[model samples]
Target: MPPHIRIYDVTQNISSMLPVYPGDPGFSREVLKSLEWGDPYTLSALHLSAHAGTHIDAPSHFIRGGRSVHEIPIERLIMMVDLIDSGTVVSPENLSGLNPLAEGVIFRTGSLTGYLSEGAARACVDRRLKLIGTDALSVDSSEEDAVHRLLLSNDMLILEGLYLEGVPAGVHTLLCMPLKIEGAEASPVRAILAPAEWHQWIL
Candidate 1:
């Protein structure tokens, strides 16, 4: 851990209130055992889509026979990231002049307006980025299949439903780890950011 670095929680809280993509299952919790029921301990059952809340999409989400959530390397989840505020649509032009060496890139394009055009997704693939994250529910709401294929085909992980409301645009160290669900196409994650120097301590 880097003692001098401040950590920022970029993940959305998982709950019934957390928004999900249209047609996807929303989060729900069932109280299996509660203190009020005279149980020794309280226990709950969580039900939600693998893609719900702050989650990561594995290549298998779009591509057939691609890597699953558990197959993704842990090193790839924690990376040196470049966070950009691309307004509504993240275009190829928005990525110009950014550090190509960053393993991950996060876009803070506000909830309603954030999404990547297919062209922008291609640009990221061209840059050989390992991972891409956004505050939006999906990278491309309109052309989701195309955009997802383009990026996932390149083995790039897609992180969605982040909470970047007050996060500034800059280079930071990203620490995002999805559930290690074997053969699962996607998994929710607890994403956070810290000073870039923290990258060295991630392993």
Candidate 2:
């Protein structure tokens, strides 16, 4: 309901060609009927992993008996976010200047570096962040998934596969709401970013 000077679409386009996490199902679309084929109207079905593209991860993803996607309130998804450029590695030292007022933090790593160190995750925990987003597919570079468990067990949400290539680094209004699929651990989202000043217009 408020005007914005600029808006950044941070969601990745889901298509057959879109790169997915290793062992995860690639995105696909089937056209059961189409106007191009003389059908009355266009109809199609999509198939993709819940974590495909830009998606948010619920605590159920790693923590046993944790909250699921639909269980999270919409208010938790929309909030003030501080985007940080943390290079290839996200460490505690680099995250020391996090914005105190921001509820969410998105790390813009120039490359697809799965380098969310344990110390870095702990730093976020110390700050009591509600959400932690990253351009990488997974927060942990190691196969142990320590980072995932550490954050999720603390009731913190994880947002992955963000498109932050040209997005500026600073405070902004995050508009990312996951699909409300009951019992789903993760869901694709159309994440967007607007100027932080737009927060005043949000109720």
What lDDT would each prediction earn against the true structure? 0.88, 0.90
RMSD of each: 1.9, 2.0
Error of 2 at 50 (Å): 0.3
Determine which window of 10 residues in candidate 1 has minimal summed lDDT. Answer: 1-10
Q: In model 2, which regions exceed 4 Å deviation?
A: 1-4
The pairs that clash in candidate 2 are: none
TM-score of candidate 1 to 2 decimals: 0.95
Instruction: State every prediction's TM-score relative to the real structure.
Output: 0.95, 0.95
Measured by lDDT, the strongest candidate is: 2
Candidate 2 lDDT over residue span 1-203, tens digit each: 86537899999998898878778889999999999999999999999999999999999999999999999988888889999999778989877788878998999876665568899999999999999999988888845689999999999999999998788899999999888999999999999999886676884
Q: Which portions of model 1 show Cα errors greater than 4 Å?
A: 1-4
Clashes of each: 0, 0
